[model samples]
Target: AQILQLLRDLVSERDTALILITHDLGVVAGMCERVNVMYAGMFMETGSADALFARPRHPYTLGLLQSVPRLDAGRRQELQPIPGAPRNMLSPPTECPFAPRCRFEVEESRQAVPPLEELESGHHVRCFNPVPAEEWQRTRVGAA
Candidate 1:
């Protein structure tokens, strides 16, 4: 933790770039201005940290966030774990890698990978069936 803080301090003081590759969302939230979520070596989503956290367009990204325990959530809040095992990275499929576990996956998801599409000024997601922003909040709370 001290090393991480020292790195952050050095980067800020010297105005240098820092590329941190981590799966820890807590670290990302604390240190990053931008975030890119990758699945099967392909970028599934990229955006500002605030934008991605506030509204995740890709099912994989949303599933990751929902699966984490949050202190802000009510005591009875349940974690929404992503179902199914991860894809085989040795020989990755040509189609969407997350399709097997994604609830919003469509026929196209299994047939071909979706191109990255911009949803807002700087937010982009690669998904054939992205969760609509209106549905994100509801779905996160198990309302959908």
Candidate 2:
């Protein structure tokens, strides 16, 4: 925590740009203005942190957020983990890398790579089918 504070101070004092690469959403929320969600070593979603967190357009990004433990959640609340393990990078499939585990998988996503599409101003996602914010939240709650 001290180190993170120091880094934050340095950036502010020096008027410098900082690129933080981390899997911890808490850190991202605390320090980042923008965010890039990566899977299989490739970015699946890129957007402002607020936009991405409020309504993730990529299934992988949604899965990641849903899997985190929320402080406001009930004590007995169960974590909604992503259904399957990550794909092997050594033998990557030509199609959408997340298809094997994504619930919104479509035929095009399985047959060909999905290009990043801008769904909103400054929000982009590489997915053929994306779950709306409400549906994703519903699914996450239902799964738990």
Candidate 3:
């Protein structure tokens, strides 16, 4: 908390940007205005923090958000783990890196890598089949 406060103070005092890199989602949610979700050395998603958190279009991003424990949950909800192991970086696949673990992956996902494309004005995602807004809303309601 103290370290975060000091960093925030520094950002405010100097009017400078801080590029924080970490696996801690809580800290990212609290501190970042924009976020880039990476997997297998490639950017899977990039967007405003609020948009990414509220409606993660990429399967990996959705999985990551689902894996986090919701503090406001009324009861215990089991974290939905991504179903497979991480890709081997030494000899990565030519196809979509997340296909093996992604529930929404299609035949096209296994054929070639998906390019990062803008879904909204500022939100971009690398996916052949992005999650729908309705599904995201349902998940959010269930989590709450």
* Candidate number that wins on TM-score, 1 or 2: 2
- Ranked by TM-score, top first: 3, 2, 1
Global CA lDDT of candidate 3, please? 0.89
Weakest lDDT window of 10 consecutive positions for candidate 1: 135-144
lDDT for model 2: 0.86
Q: What lDDT tens digits, residue by residue, belong to model 2 across residues 20-136?
A: 999898899889999999998878999999887777889998888888887768899898789988888898679999999999999999898888889899899999998777776
lDDT of 1 by residue, 31-118 (tens): 9999999988989999999888888899999988888787777899788799999988888588899999999989999999899999
What are the lDDT figures for the candidates, one per model?
Answer: 0.88, 0.86, 0.89
**TM-score of predicted model 2?**
0.90
User: Candidate 1, 52: how far from true, in Å?
Assistant: 0.2
lDDT of 3 at 130: 96
Reference-based lDDT, residue 63, model 1:
87
Top-TM-score structure, candidate number: 3
| Model 3 error, position 3 (Å) | 0.5
Residue 67 CA displacement from its true place in model 3, Å: 0.8
For each candidate in turn, the TM-score is 0.89, 0.90, 0.93
Better of 1 and 2 by lDDT: 1
Model 2 regions lying over 4 Å from their true place = 136-144
RMSD of model 2, in Å?
2.7
